[model samples]
Target: MAKQERAVRTRKALITAAAEVFSREGYRTASLTVISRLAGVSSGALHFHFPTKSALALAVEEAAADRLRVIVERCEKFEQPEGPIRLVVDASYQVVEQLAADPVLRAGFELGGHTVEMGSSGRVCDLWQRWVASVLEHAQGAGGLRSEVVPGHVAGLVVAVTAGLEELGRRDPRWLAHPTLTTFWRLVLPQVAPAGTSVPLQFAGS
Candidate 1:
């Protein structure tokens, strides 16, 4: 039991260390030596868990996917007093928060962008788009959206805007902060929601 616990700790440490290096250096330039050193583990141990740099990167991507799944599930299950539209907006903010806080998740996005193959959640952009589309569809069905509003268009816009924000976050961490996200929602919500639907532009958690 103790040995298994130690192994688990070491594996987590390696993944965390890898995420930091991968986040800073990206996949091609990031080195196992640096990752192992950051992990305070021997090269042998890193090799034991991940045979190659690509393997470590895959682990990071998988772990990132798992974390993203948690964030998505949380948003899906989270209760909102206002309506589905507000829930969708707030959920988008939550995703930004996660990206801001977790370098692994951020790096996974970067690494996955380099490859055509989809990572967990079927690519970050797709995941965000699908969720927004789902919420927008629900809002339309519930009569929460404006009659002229198109859910598919709204979903695409939201996905594009958020993708741009994630890219901008690479240069300015503040892009992921509440100020920018809330401002966007504040401006856009009115256009998306039905007139006087009581949908607030700001999220309380933000």
Candidate 2:
């Protein structure tokens, strides 16, 4: 039991260390020696768990994907007062929050955009864009969206804005704060919401 626990801890440490190193140096330049050293584990242990840097990078990407999945699933389960659009807004807030707080997520997103030779798992950004599109489709069906709103175009705009904010937040973390997204929704909600709908700016913009 003790040995199993230690192994889990070691694997986790290696993944985190690898994420940090990969995020800082890029996949091509990241050193196994640096990862192992940062993880405080021997190279032997890292090799035992990951075999190769590509395998380790794949694990990091999977882990990051899982985190994003949790955020979306959580929003789906929660009943928002303003319906799908509000849920989308809340989900965006949660994503920026996670990106700001979690290095593994940051590294995963960074790595996703890079030309790493990891296996065939889709990029996190692509996954996120698909999710946004699906949510907007739901909103359109439920009459939550304006009649003129094209779900695909709105999805594109939301994805582009969120992706831009994620990049900007790396240089200035304030870009990821609640106010950033709140203000965004404040401006965008009226445009996207049904004509007669009153956007709850007070709840979100506050």
Candidate 3:
């Protein structure tokens, strides 16, 4: 393989290995030696791709962010005839499902909260909040929000609830299930969606 292609594979391998270690052992305890061993790459090769454990963690977090962006974008494609509120709900549900299945994404969120040890990768939870707020703001601009509802407040609530679910999922895998998220949206949609608008108990494309 060419140097560039080799580098790409090495980097991907390192990130994947890092995700497994971080998810299984967490930021403080996960070792680069184990990560290199898991990737079946030499220590030099791991260093060539990620010079430090923090660098590898950052890479994993970046990949997770990209995955989340894809999730939200996918929700945009299947726009419900109902409103933007439904779009946000579906998007949030998709993220929960993705988090449950994808250990990499889950690890990204895990490492994100470990900023004290992981350097300055920033909080993935903050990214999640901003994304939720942006989606809710779109709904507000489209007049889909309830007359009494504040878009920012609702967005914060969504972030807290989803984060709580993700945290719970760390302990009990069932917290990441479809019914768990659907139950959340089922309660949220009725309050946020315009009065008399029949928000489905189950989200579309669930």
Estimated TM-score for each candidate? 0.85, 0.89, 0.89
Question: What clash pairs does model 1 have?
Answer: none
Residue 65 of candidate 2: its Cα lDDT? Answer: 79
The per-model lDDT (C-alpha) reads 0.79, 0.83, 0.81
Candidate 2 lDDT (Cα, whole model)?
A: 0.83
lDDT of 1 by residue, 65-120 (tens): 67777877887786777778877887777778888888877876776765334234
> In model 1, where do residues sit more than 4 Å from their true spots?
115-122, 203-206
- Clashing pairs in model 2, backbone N/Cα/C closer than 3 A: none
Count clashing residue pairs per candidate.
0, 0, 0
Across residues 1-206, which tens digit of lDDT does each residue of candidate 2 receive? Answer: 99999999999999899988887778889999999999999999999999988888888887887888999999899887778887777788788889898878777788776624545466777778889889889989999998899988888888788778877877798888778787887788889898777655433634
**lDDT tens digits, residue span 79-117, model 3:** 697778877777777888888888778887887776546
Those runs of model 2 whose alpha carbons end farther than 4 Å from true positions after fitting are 115-117, 201-206
**Model 1 TM-score, 2 decimals:** 0.85
Lowest-sum lDDT 10-residue window in model 1: 114-123
Q: Pick the candidate with the highest lDDT.
A: 2
